[model samples]
Target: MPDENFYLDNDDIRFNLTHMVDLESIAELKEDVGSPDCAYESADEVVETYLDLLEDPIGVLAAQRIAPRAADVDKEGCHYDNGTVTLPEPARLNVQDLAEADLMGMTLPTRYGGLNFPATLYTAATEMISRGDASLMNLFGLQGIAETINLFASDELKDKYLPGFCTGEHSGAMVLTEPDAGSDLTAVQTRAAYEEDHDHFHLTGTKRFITNGCGEVLLVLARSEDPEKYGGGRGLSLFLVEKDETVTVRRIEEKLGIHGSPTCEIYFNNSEGYLIGQRGRGLTRYVNWLMNAARLGVAAQAVGISEAAFAEARAYAQQREQFGQPLDRFPAVQEMLVRMRIDIEASRALMYATAETVDMEMLLSEKLERLDRKDPRYADLRARRDRFAKAAEVLTPLAKYYTSEKSISVTTDAVQVHGGNGYMKEYAVERLYRDARITSIYEGTSQIQIDRAIPRVMAGAFEALLDEYADRDYGTVALNGLREALAEARRSLQAAVAYVNDQKLADDQRDTDYRNLTARMVCDMALDTYLSYVFLEQARHSERKAAVAAKFIQDMAPRVEMNRQYVMSGDRSVLQQFDLLTGAQS
Candidate 1:
């Protein structure tokens, strides 16, 4: 078994949750935060209860149960036997332990026999699981399925499926991608035909690259009506497809990494499925509901992988002797380790901030649903909930994009730190590197995440928030300098955005080029701002974190300015001379 000491302790999780981010204050505004009977049991208690669970021996169980199996699962992968897709032995054992521990439904509501954990807390657990073994995070991190059912499934559907899911009796798949409609879900060709006599939908389609596609239950996105009649997401409907004889797992793809989570090409031939939510709202509503949770899960998985990579590199650096000294004593090696540490921490800071904000809103919305229509305060709470929901919509994808991409960078560097040894199958960093590749690709690609974030960026939501961050009093004279440096980077991003808008593209290529340039500036500034705020919060506790934060701002501020300048001043060389760049063409 791997060293359990590397797993995230309860104190570290709490530190990230409570101090670096504003979990309790946000919770206080949320009515569904705590027990109704005791008003005195504030959000603080709610947070502590959550932390206490992290300290449980179950914490050790949750992290350890899956750790030992990661390697074998990766080696054996998933096997499709006849119609049934059999998971690798290690994968099977890992899922079984998760189910037995009731961790499969980590973020689902208690009403569905789940733990009713906050997204932040759930993400923290995900990080721990990922650290132990990145491959297992795919299986363990998909509590999104239960969350999806809780939000969209009717009482009948929820009653039938959620308990099984919560208890780990069932695993699930999001059956959205098809051969033609990988990224463009609006192009989904899977047909969900309504049966007038039976009043049930019969789904017939082939879905490719479906993650955990062989799971017991499937949330399928299918076209129910022609676009000429209903249209796009409006033509689409969500279905709860129980895996019976009608649905066949034709084959599980030989994946590049995270092989434990079965990625299957499924054939749904006249499969019976219950409609979830209203007709024509499946893609628009249910898919959105599912994807939001999934996006967050990806962020957690990324963090976990980072944790694993960091542990491997940090441990190796301390033990591995170089030039008659420990590698840590060497400047180049120390720099590599420092960068890896910062990368992980930066990703984590963004993940927790996003999760905390989103969970608070989820809690508020749950409370609002419980409030009577006649209650005087119901309207106010409902309005606040709506605002938080919108805020979460912007933040979730942003965090997912930032963290997953960071994991790719950090994990790759982790392997690099081990030099040639990292490339060998014997090293965990090699596995960690492969595992991290899937984080940005699935649950929507980094491109998709940015497409989601771009609207929020264009809307100037972060610009307004920047003002709020600027207004924060960094009381220490030394720290105030770093705050000013961050403010400058925020302005550079603003200038870059203005430049992009000023350059109206006539061609698709030019438009894409401009968007990519703009995206870099936006993401860079967002990360800088996020870290600046994280370190500012850290200053409230440790001087060490404050110093790290200060160094981060100083290093990042100039990079932000340079990126912004490239966006603003770099030639529209692509726009001005496309033919020149194309040369004789391929």
Candidate 2:
């Protein structure tokens, strides 16, 4: 069994918690000073105590307890007998350990038996959990389900569900995807009907590929409009349904990776459900809110998997010899190790930056809601909230798109670093590589993320944010040089966006197609420029980080220009020749 505490041993995570993130400020906002729900003397105390908890009981549990059992959990997998899904013994034990630590409701209000930590801290803990066992993080990370109910569900529902979720007595699933309605949720065929006599709604639909679908509480999306007046997504409503005699687990998928987390096909035959929030806003409001947070959680999972893969590969490289010298001494192997670590750090920086913005948004939202209409602070706070919301919108998809893609590269390199051994199941990288494959596909694919992010990139959303980062003083000549390189890349990106916009606006019939074709290059340049700023900001904290920033800026500046050049080409051959290239029937 590994005895090293995952949180304490990781210098990068330690750096983030101590310096990169303002946990103290977030704690001050999240915790009530007058009468604290958690045991704390002050905001500093809250920060201190929380970090301690993560190191000892929580991080220790993850590294010492969960990491040891992950192999067995993956091997035994989940068993579906008769209609119920049961976790393997190791997986069950992992859940039990987390529940014992009162970790199931990391983001809920303390009033509801939760710690009420900000999303920043909650996501940090999630990274550690995923590092321990990526499969287990699926079950553990669904705490966001309870948070969604708290946000949109009725008070009656919150009273009944929040306590159970916080106490680990109950677990839940978002329950959105269907066999026919995977990416396009508007195609959801599930039906929900109100039974006024019983004062409830009945949900009848099938949900496929649901993570932890066997959970006790399910927040389902169903079409609720009148047949004659259906309005696409507007016709959909969110429902809080429970697992009962009416709900059945039809089958569990077996294959690729994360086997400990069951991918379920579930059937709801008139299952009793209560309407959550107002009617006709399920996909537009509730599910959108749930999915944005879920995408962030997936990014955390990707970075955790990257961390694990790097550790495995680095350990092997140090010990294994190539021809007469240790593998790490070789330029080829050393380059792989260096790039893998830099990628992990860059992803972590982006993920935490996005999470911090979300945390601020949540805090300001609560304040804006409670303040009187005439209060002077209301307008200023609301403006800040709106800006944060926009930043969060761009950063969330960018984080998801980049983190998942980088994780795939990092894990693939782990396999390559091990030569043939990494391909064998005997190695941890083999499983980590398999596990990392699904992050890009689920929640939302990378293509889907690009489609969502491009409009914001084109809208010049990064202009103000980049300006704020640019104003910061780096305190060193080398760091200033990196900042200037990033600035040059930003200028190139702005020009590319202008060119694409000008071209698309000029064409009426093919504008949308043209935009779609160039979307990836636009988003790539935007992300490359944005991520360079992130690393430059990190350069202030450590000399080693400054070196990392130098290497990354040097590497990405030319790539950003290259991507911009591609967009400037006005390439329409892909669309014009689609029929010829594919030999399609006209």
Candidate 3:
């Protein structure tokens, strides 16, 4: 029997898709391209057909197949025997069900056996799958690896790997991390050298902390340039290696959460492989693209976990009694529940917006490529493409940083709402809390996201977005106060950016020195302002969202102001007193 409580039935996702997303534009783009499998005549038809045919089935799978087995899968985890990794029986069965349903390749082109859905719909599906079992997302989300191959690999390579991916006969792993190179990927020591006699490259090195490393296809980043001749990231190149005897699974890490998702340590000993894209551009071009997509996937995963956590808390609070009344009747419990709900909605709004932008960027790029360079329409299309591309650069990191961090906080609070019961293994909140911890750590850390976002905030990328939001008028009089609050938050963000710029000019190295210290402050301000606007826009069509917007702005605007003040204070005491503060390193 299907769990009637599937998170996909949540009203907010449906509202966002129907009202907030630009489905008309997406439909027109798809129709213009004469989509092979999906040929809806109108935007409404596309949305209706997608929900009925694709999204609904995915939701059913999550409720019936995935969610029911998640706990058992966690207990069993994955097995390591000799050099092979075997998934828990429940996990293995879940994968088979998803593959048999043709749900593995949601975003790739139809010609490659994918559904060819836009990123927004794909994100929606990912959220549902993650909510069912966060560990399963590790396998389902790896479809990005296949998408990368479709985008950058040769036609020969595409024909070789994509069909297997769609058929569930193959899975993939991104093999990049080494013992010495975790966050600093440029330090990777893996070697991939061409063998003249064999006419194929041979990969040799150890890759640690690899997710799904035992999968059929592996994307490995290796040093193609000799270190003595070329150093740093310029020496790096991407390669595609299939599972063979030459590639060995050394061991799988016993992790705190997501136990069903094996994190393997792999040894590639002269593994036969083929190169991807141009040499010397792997890290800068290909891997960066892969990382951005992965980050968005993490953001969706975070949202999914939050949804599950919130549901558990809300249901428990409503049923569990204290002093002869439901716990939800208590004011303290009410506050926690409301805050968790608000955070979940805010995070979803931001995530879907980011996904929509990414979809536009991808669709426009494809359209631009198809047009003649000398065509007059090409210039306009190029401008739209670049705009969305830049938006994606800032929004992707923001979505990842904010949503992942919020998931952890929300899950912690969910446990708190459950009190002693949440600490027990019997409660789902306990597992969710553990699972939420890694979302902010991998793909890129919260600190890394702040560092990337600081320069974009400083350069006025967010300023235009803020202005656009401010200029839009909400039809309801009730939302005017929320609009004003959003305006104030935007102003506060601008002040923080101005202060950071002034500090940067005061010292030649201040940008490098002080940026990291103050980056989080700026990012918080940006997130609050951005989400406030997102919710406000959502309010135009939804009364429930109007209340969500009101509560979020009323609660969060003050914090944004406080963060701005902290940035403006220009306190350098931490940097100045580092030695004293640290007590001589021991």
Off by over 4 Å in 3: 1-8, 31-38, 505-510
TM-scores for all candidates: the values are: 0.93, 0.97, 0.97
1-586, model 2: which lDDT tens digit per residue? Answer: 5677889888988887788888887777677544545466788998987788778777898889988887888889899998989999999999998988989888888779987878887788888888889998899899889999999888888999999998899999889899899888888889998998998889898999999999999999999888568667989999999899999999999969998998899999999989988889999998988999999999999999999999999999999997998999999999999999999998998899899889888888887786897998888989999998999998998898899999999999999999999999889999999999999989889999988888898889989788888777888888887787777898998898888777745535437677789898888888778878878888898989888888988889889988988889887888889888787845
Q: Once superposed on the true structure, which residue ranges of model 2 sit more than 4 Å away at CA?
A: 34-41, 505-510, 583-586
State the lDDT of candidate 1 residue by residue for 165-224, as single tens digits.
888888888889999987788889899999989998999999999888888889899888
Error of 3 at 439 (Å): 0.6
The true-versus-predicted C-alpha distance at residue 534 of model 1, in Å, is: 2.7
What lDDT does the true structure give each of the candidates?
0.78, 0.88, 0.87
Candidate 2's displacement at residue 286, Å, is: 0.7
Q: Write the per-residue lDDT of candidate 3 for residues 1-586, one digit (tens) a residue.
A: 6455354468887887878888668756754534554466666776665666434578888878898898998889899999989999999999999998888887777888888778788788888888989999999999889988998999999999998999889999988899999888999999989898986789999999999999999999999988888798999999999999999999999999998899999999999989898887788889999989999999999999999999999999999999999999999999999999999998898898888889889888888877899999999999988888888889999999999999999999999999999999999999999999999998889888877777888898887677778877788777876787677788788888887877754445556567678888888888888888888888888677788888988898789978988888878888888887889754
Q: Candidate 2, 85: how far from true, in Å?
A: 0.9
